[model samples]
Target chain A: MNRHTDTPAGTELLDLPMPEPRTCPFGPAPVYDRLRAEAPVTRVACPTGLTAWLVSRYADVRDVLGDAERFSSRPGQVVHLMAHADPERPIGEGEFTRMDGPEYQRFRRHMGPEISSPRRLAKLRPLVRAVVDERIGALAAAGPPADLYQDFAIPVTTASIGGLVGVPYADRDLFHTAASGVFSDVTDQVQLAAAVRPLQGYLFELVRRRRVEPEDDALSRMVARAPSAEPPFSDVELVAMSAVMLVAGFDSTATALAHGVLALLNDPGQWARLRDDPSLVPGTVEEMVRLFGGGAGIVREATVDTEIGGRPVAKGDYVILAIQSANHDPEAFPDPGRLDVARDTEGHLGFGHGTHQCFGQQTARLELTVALEALVRRVPSLRLAAPLADVPFKTGTSVVGPERVPVTWDEILPAEGEGP
Target chain B: MRVRADTALCVSTGSCALTAPEVFDLGEDDGVVVVLVESPPDEQRETVGRAVRACPAGVLSLAP
Candidate 1:
C-alpha cells in the first residue's frame, strides 16, 4: 500500500488509505505529489454512497477547513469513517465537535478553560512529565526487547488522557479498555453499542458525581458551567463531551507518540542528535508529529455552492481535506520529505485548522514534549528492534501509526536527581 | 505591525504562542490568545507574521 503505483487505470477513483498508502514511510505517498501536481481536487467515491472532492493542495485544504460558514463539519468525522457499515454516530448533546455555529461555540467556550487554556496546559505539564517518566521507568523495569507502542507509549498517553478527563488511577484500566472499545474498528451496531454502553454509563455516573462535588478537572469544570449555560446544560451533555475527549483524544495522541518515536528512531542521526541536545526535543516533537503524527484527514461537507481552487463544488458536496498531503505539500514545506528538527514546523495542518480544530492539541503537545524528552534522556541507548519497513503500520484503523514499535535498550540511564 | 486577537474565535491550538512567543501567549485561565506585544519590534516582524499565519482559527491579525 506504500506507493499506490498500480497505475490508476485512469478511472479508479481514490479510496481509503489516502496519504500513506506512501512510497516512503518518512513522508506521505507519492500519489499525493502526482495528485497535487495533476489534479489537487479530484473525486473520491466513498463507501457511504457519497462523493467526496478530495482536496490535496495546502492552501485549498486550509481554505476549506478555515471557512466553517461555507464548509460545514455537520456530517462529522463519521463521513470519513463511514465505511464497512460504520454506523453514523449520533452527535450527542454536548458533542460540539460535530456541531455548527453557536451550539458548537457554546460548548467550546465552556470546555476551553479546563481542557486547553494556557492555564490548563501549565497545570497539566507536571502531570504529563510524572506520568511519562513513570511509564518509561516501568518500561525499563520490564526490561528491553519491548513494544514501546503497547508498553510505554500507550500507557503514558492513556494516563495523560486520564488526567485530562479526570479518570482516577485505579479506574484507568476500565477506562482504557472502554476507551479503546469506543474507538475500536467494530462497526456492527450490536458490538458498537456493547462497547459504548458501559463507557457511557460510567461517564454518566462520573458527570453526576462531578455535579455533586466538583473536582479540579475538565468534567468538573463542565459541571460548574452547566447551570450558567445559555440554554442550560444537562448532565447527559457533560458525559457526552467527556466521551468526545476520550474518543477523540485517546487513539490519536497514542499513535502520534508511537509514530513520532518510530520516525525519530528510524533516522539514527536524528535520534543521536536529539539524545545529545535535549533542547532540540521540542522542535523535534513538532517535526516528527508533522511528518509522522497528526490526525487522519478531516471531512467537511459544503453547505453552499463553493469552488475549491476554481473547481466547481456544488452545495451538499463533501470535501476530504488530505491533511497529511497538505503537510507534505512542497509549496508550504520546502523539502517536505526531509525531517529538519529546527525547521519552522509551525502551521502544519497536523492538528487541523479553523473553528473546529483539535480540542486536545495542547495536551497532545505536552504529552509528546515530556514523553520524547524523557524517553531520549532516560533511554539514551534506545534503538528500534525492527526496521521501519518491517514494522507494521496501522493503515487498517483511522488513526495511522506503527502498530507495535518494538525497541531494545542496552542500559537504563538515570536522571539528574536520581541515584547513579 | 500591530496585532489583534479575537479570543471568541480561538480554539487555543496555541500556534501563535509557540510561533511568536514574544508577541503572543495563551491566557493562563481561559487559554485564549493574549497579545504580549501589540506592536512587535522590527526583529520580531517575520515571526509575528508566522504566528498569525499559524493560527488555524484565524484569531490573530496584523495591521501595518
Candidate 2:
C-alpha cells in the first residue's frame, strides 16, 4: 500500500505540503499564487509523505480533471495519507469516486438521475426550503449569540440530505456523527477504518431494509433501480454508493453553508445587498460557492503520459487540482478576492469540472440559496458576535470551514404575520 | 443560433441549465443534457454561449 515505494527512480520530489493551510479564511495558501504563476503543474509532498503534482491554473486544473481516460480516479493511483497504513484494495470497488471507465459510469448512471434530474430537484426544493425555515425558526426562538454552524447550517444540510437518503429524522444525529468521522482529517489508518466501519454497516442495513420494503426516498429509488442494471448492483456496491453520497453530500454542503454565512457577515455590504434584494439570493449563493474553499482535496492520477500547463506528467503520477487557486485565478474571475454578489461566476471550479464534477451541485445550490435567503430575511440585523480572527477554522481536512461561527443579532424580528 | 449537446460526453453537472435554462434541461430519465431549443432566438444566443463555456463536460456547442 506504500504508493511512494512505486515512485519512479530519479524523480525529484519537492518538499511542499499538500493543501498548504490558509493564513486567511478567504484566500488560499500564498504558495498557490506563486505556483500558478511559476509552475502550474509541479511536484509537491503530500500529507501521506508521498509526492504528487499540484495543478494551480484554472485551465490546467480543468484539463487534468476533465480528461478521464488520460487521468484515472482509481484509489491506488492517488496519494492518500492513510494509503500506506491500510491494506491494498480493489481500484473500482468501494465508491464510484475510486472507479474509472465503465464501472464508474454504471454506478453514476444509476445514482445521477436520482440526485440531478430537474423534475426531482424541483420537487425537493420545497422540502429543502422547509428544512431551512424550521432550522431558522429554531435559531430565532433560541435567542441571540448562537453558533450558526451548529444551530442552523449543520441541521439544515444534514436534515435535507438525510431526508433525501431516507434516514429517519430521529437518526440524523447518528448519521451525522458517523458521516463526519469518515470525512474528518484523521490520518491514523486504524482510526480512519474505525470511523468508516460504522457508516458502512449503517448504510448496509438501511439498504437491506429498503430492498424489502422500499420507501419514497433516494435510497429506495436506488434500491428499485438496482435490478435494472446489466448485472444488477450487489448489496456491497449499493452500500458503498450510499455511503459515498452521504459523506460527500453532507460534509461539503455543510461546510459551504457555514463559510458562506461567515463571508456574508464579514462583508456587511454584501449582507445588506442580499437582504435588500431577496431576488439576489441565488446569484449570491453562486458567488459564495465560487469564493469558498470546498474542492481543495480533489486528486487525479495520470493513466497516460501527458502534458499540463506545459509540464510533463508521467503515467501513474498523482496530480492534485488546486481548486481554490483555480477559482481565484484572475484570468477566470475578475476582482477574484472581493465578494461581489453580482459577479458572473460562470465557470468556477467550486463543484469542480469534467466527468467527476459534483452530481449534487444543483441540490446544494438550492439548499444554500434557500437557507441564506431565509436567514437574512428573518434576522435583518444579524452580525458576528466574535472577532473574525477568533473564529475556529477546521484545517488539515479536504474541506475547509469554520468550526464555530458565533453570531448575535439585534431584536429577533417577529415572525411574519405577527407584524408590528 | 443552433445549439446541440453531445449527450455521450455530458455528465449532468447542470451548468447549462443553470446558465441558460430556456435552451437546455437535464433529461428526466438519463440525467444527460437535453437541448430544449435547437435554434435559439437571437436574444438567447449570449446565454447559450455562456452555457457552452460553463459546461464542465464541454458537451454543448453552437453551430459555427
What's the TM-score of each model vs. the native? 0.90, 0.91
What CA RMSD would candidate 1 show? 4.3
Report model 2's interface C-alpha RMSD after superposition on the true interface residues: 2.0
Where does candidate 1 chain A have its weakest 10-residue lDDT segment?
Answer: A1-10
Assess candidate 2 and give its TM-score to the true structure. 0.91
Every candidate's TM-score, chain A alone: 0.91, 0.92
Residue-wise lDDT of candidate 2 within A1-420, one digit each (tens)?
Answer: 245335445555565544432465876777777777876777677656656777788898877778989987774423354433221355545557777666666776677777776667777888888888777678778888899888888888888888888886677656566555655556465666676777778788889899899988989988887887767888888887777766667767888888888988999999999889989888888888888754454677778888888777777677777888889898899778788888887778888777777877877887888888778888889999998888888765656778889999986654445553
Worst lDDT run of 10 residues, candidate 2 chain A, spans A78-87
lDDT of 1 by residue, A1-420 (tens): 112122224535677444452357666667788889998988776555555778888899888888999998877664555343321356656657778776787767667666665556778888888887788778778898999888888788878888878887667656556555545444555665666677789898898888889888878877776787688778777877787777667678888878778877888888898888989988887787778644357688788877999988777776788888898999999999887777888778877788887777778878888888898888999999986778887754667777888899998776546786
- DockQ, computed on Cα atoms, for candidate 2: 0.57
Candidate 2 CA-lDDT value:
0.75
